[model samples]
Target chain A: DAGVTQSPTHLIKTRGQQVTLRCSPKSGHDTVSWYQQALGQGPQFIFQYYEEEERQRGNFPDRFSGHQFPNYSSELNVNALLLGDSALYLCASKINGGYEQYFGPGTRLTVT
Target chain B: AQSVAQPEDQVNVAEGNPLTVKCTYSVSGNPYLFWYVQYPNRGLQFLLKYITGDNLVKGSYGFEAEFNKSQTSFHLKKPSALVSDSALYFCAVPRAGSYQLTFGKGTKLSVIP
Candidate 1:
């Protein structure tokens, strides 16, 4: 089966600009979660989406938001981007009650 | 909430030698732990996890982890190291009452030839 997939392998945006990244979860997963991996650091939770609603969010600012469509595909939106926002955006998905989360290749976002 | 720690910033081992990447956790009850490896510029690849079954959990790429309840540790181990095994390894656990994973700072494993 095809694993999780993400769009726009790489992106570059200027400060104060907005960008959107897309993700398609694994074949049978229903819950989608987003993570940010900065240089030389581990992945940090951004937020999680289930049933088209954001269930849990990390310490990110309001500038970061997301949406999950009925088909289980999701989109991550970041507004007023800053240089610090430059990082690898990772998308992971799992079954509603499963513990293991499969990840996508991720979208690299660079705020210049 | 549960938190995990990877005390070592970097671990270097010779190829063909056994390797160990340490991880310790802090939690009140049963701990669900996971291990993931990230190659350069790539997303994490799941290795193994410890739930409530046997203490030894085997995962992908000839990797295994031993869960110790008394020590509160879940260490990743391999019988013999390989050059391709060099990567950044992270230990993670779910936050209390949620599915969000709290990842350790990560341990960089370098299997030198």
Candidate 2:
């Protein structure tokens, strides 16, 4: 009955640096999606992973990437981070083909 | 392109009063819409969704939404406002044939006690 969990609750990085965020899907959930939420704005889709392969991605550039482990956990990696990359990174999971997704607390990334 | 719009940037309501947060979406064919809420410094939580049947859908926390086909809108409603209910709400619609979702900018609800 565990909900989605994320690691590195808070992060600080300088411009051009790299950062990685981690997430563990809810128990029994198989699909994981990533999103970036800027202050005072809704989340923007990043990419999604299923069956250890990326299934779909948003309009974000290649600098943003992700991976899903066989255990249903996932990681979001950002390279050459910019100040605009500072935001809350959220990870959500749901059963395959399920419409409802449960989310984690999210990792806050701060780029200076 | 699929899109969702929350016309209101912020909404204020008196405690115990009913409240409505408007959301509108444009997409092809039958739309699969969803409502999500986010608290301060937290991730978005699923509130409800409308896939098919019953234009009026009830969701968690005594919240419900009405789907208006003619207007291409889905408005979130709650009979009574709670101070605890004050949070950011987002309306989202998945891209057709795509696994990603398009979300509204979000509406911030503030309930005055």
Counted clashes in each candidate structure: 0, 0
The parts of candidate 1 lying over 4 Å away from their true place are none
- Per-prediction DockQ comes to 0.76, 0.76
Q: What is the interface RMSD of each candidate, in Å?
A: 1.0, 1.2
Tens-digit per-residue lDDT, B1-113, candidate 2:
99999999999999999999999999988899999999888888889999999999999999999999999999999999999999999999998887577889999999999
Tell me the TM-score of model 1. Answer: 0.98
* Clash pairs, model 2 backbone: none
Candidate 1 docking: what grade? medium
Worst 10 residues of 1 chain B by lDDT: B37-46
- Fnat, model by model in order, equals 0.64, 0.72
Where's the lowest-lDDT run of ten residues in candidate 2 chain B? B94-103
CA lDDT, candidate 2, residue B111: 98
Every model: Cα RMSD to truth = 0.9, 0.9
Off by over 4 Å in 2: none
